[model samples]
Target: MKQKISLITTGGTIASKETKNGMLSSGALSGDELAALCKLPDDIEIRIVDFMKVPSMHMNFHRMLALRDAINKELEDPDVTGVVVTHGTDSLEETAYFLDIVTEDKRPIVVTGSQRSPQEVGTDVYSNLRNSIYAAANPLLENGGVVVVFNERIYSAKYVKKVHASNLQGFESFGYGYLGIIDNDVVSIYQKPLHREFFSVQNEIPRVDIIKCHTGADGLFIDASVAVGAKGIILEGVGRGQVTPQMVSSIQKALDSGTNIVITTSAEEGKVHPAYDYEGSAFDLKERGVILGADYDSKKARIKLAVLLACKNKIKSSDFKY
Candidate 1:
């Protein structure tokens, strides 16, 4: 029997076109239009769903959940081997992680996007989309949670990040590296995540904000987030998750007001550990009721924090350990 794959297009550079003004208009093509331009595999069967046509920046909690539902709906058919989602590269990692956490199926959920529009020279649109379809149909990727296929490389949604603005190799999994690569339409596996996590999003995703810590930085952002009724805050601290002394007061204030605050490192590698006892050190913040964010970046931490807040049970520091 031929493998069946579900291809859902949500609009991104892969579907974008060059506008009359010479700027790229994102998501200009429908799903069928984009697929028609690509040379898809003849051995496999593909099902297309033109889910949405918008830039990645326009993706919000409602749409993310809706996308998850759409994927779940497609998976109801046992004949479907896996799924591929075309997205914008700008916020691709965030949406990938969001799907990783909430998607209920073990079959591969491969998310992909191109850095250049289809009309551009030396474009990666065709190759990336074609490779993603193969990756989605491959059984080796099953039970691995969500994965992002870009520049012929497959990345775990948990660690992938958009590292470049316009390069074809726009996504990377620093420290851990990519899970695998797709070469010549064949998918190869190098490794897989040791574990996958899922959370039931029973409530509306709450307001989670990320505040970056810099030299002489204060708690203005934290204060603003709390005033606006943010349920969680992620502190993108520097070097082992140390914030400026000035931001400590506002962090404590947010914690006192029952806002979930997590401290994450700005470094590409290394988890936030409480090694020092300074005023704004990880140890100090941990003692003051801040959860260590491990190695997650600010955007990823924000997504997980929001999902956890929306899920059942009281949130705990142990919840972010994975």
Candidate 2:
């Protein structure tokens, strides 16, 4: 029997087309158009779903939820083996991670995007999408949760990040590396996440913001976020998660106002640890009810926090220990 896979397209560079002005129009091509350009596997039956046509930056929580619903709808089919989502590289990691947390299905949900437009020379649009479909249908990835397939590598959504601006090798998982790779149309698996998490979120995703810390940074942004009624804030701190002393007051005030704040390190690798006693150190922040994000990039932390809040989960320090 031929393996059946659902190809859900949300647009990205892979679906972009060159405009008259010599600039690329993101998501200019439809799902069927993009799929038609690729020499997809003949052994697999592909079902194309044109969900949306927009740039990655245009993606928001509401749309993400809608995409999740659409994917889940496809999964309801018993013959469908898995799913492959073509997205823009800009926000692909966040969307992938969001699906990873909310999608409870054991079948793989593979997200992929190309850095170059499909019309460009040396574009990766064909290979990435093709590899993703194979990876999605692979039985070894059945319980591995959502994965990002790009440039032949399969990365866990939890750890993957876009590392380069325009390189074909745009996505990377940093310290953790990739789960496996697809070579010559063959899907190979070397590892899988030991644990998976799913949150059943029925409500709208709450407002979540990410604030980057720098030298002499103050609490103004934090206060503003709180004033705007943000449900969660991710603090991208430096070194072992240390913010400027001036920012601590605003962070504390936000906490007082019931804003869930997670402190994540900006470093490529390493967990946020309470290592110092300074006013804005991770230790001090944790003492004041801040959650330490365990090696999660700020964007991923923001996605998780928003999902957790949407699920009405009580924010806790231990919540980030995935």
Candidate 3:
């Protein structure tokens, strides 16, 4: 029997080509172009879902919701073994992490992107896409949430971060490292993400804002975010998730305004711990109703907070079971 796979195409460097003016991210490639590039095995039956062909920075909650729905739709077909999403590297990690929390564990879902456009030399598009196919087709993570495949490394979406500005090794799984690796000639698995929590899609996804805490942040962004109907806020703070004194007041105001606040470390690799006792310390923030983001980065924390706020009554901290 053929290995049935559903491939979703959302434009990125993978589907880009050089134009006279500049490298364009558009419908430069899709089904046929990928088929030609990967030359997938004869026994693998690939079905393409051309959702969008735009850069990843343009990916928002609405588009991500649509993508989520698309993946769910594909899983409805018992014949489809797994799903693969080709996305832009810019916001790919955020999207993957979002999908990880909301997508019910059913079938494998692999997301991959390239650092360089296909028109550029040393492009990793075809290689990453091919390896992603290998991951989706195999049963490695069949009882899945979401995984990011790049530079032959397989990372759990929950922990993956795009660490480098421009490199084939753009991704890092932080403390967890990669779950596995894959190449054209080989496939390997060392570990897998052990937990997943899902939420029901809401009619309207809530607005959540992220503010990076800096030395002189005066809480303007926090007040502005709350003013703009933000249901939640994520504060990427300094060491051990400490914010400036000025930010603490605005954060308290946000919490009083019924907005959920989550604190994360801007450092990228460690968990948010309540160690400091100063005015803007995690201890102070937590006492003021801010939630600790644990090991989650700011982007992923925003995703979690949004989903939780979207389904407020239905989910609890225990639901995440962190």
Expressed as tens digits, the lDDT of each residue in 1-322 for candidate 1 is 8999999999989999888999988998999999999999998999999999999999999999999999999999999999999999999999999999999799999999999999889999999999999999999999999999999999999999999998888989899999999999889999999989998787989999989999999999999999999999999999999999999999999999999999999999999999999999999999999999999999999999999999853678898889
State the lDDT of candidate 3 residue by residue for 97-130, as single tens digits.
8888788857899999888887677888878988
For candidate 1, the lDDT comes to: 0.94
Q: How many Å off is the CA of 122 in candidate 1?
A: 0.6
List clashing residue pairs in candidate 3. none
Number of clashing residue pairs, candidate 3: 0
lDDT of each: 0.94, 0.93, 0.83
- Model 3 lDDT, full chain set: 0.83
**Clashing residue pairs in candidate 2 (N, C-alpha, C atoms within 3 angstroms):** none
Per-residue lDDT of 103 in model 3: 87
Worst 10 residues of 3 by lDDT: 313-322
Q: Tell me the spans in candidate 1 whose CA falls farther than 4 Å from its real position.
A: none
Candidate with best lDDT: 1
After aligning candidate 3 to the native by TM-score, how far in Å is the CA of 236 from where it should be? 0.7
Off by over 4 Å in 2: none
Candidate with the larger TM-score of 1 and 3: 1
Clash counts for the predictions, in order: 0, 0, 0
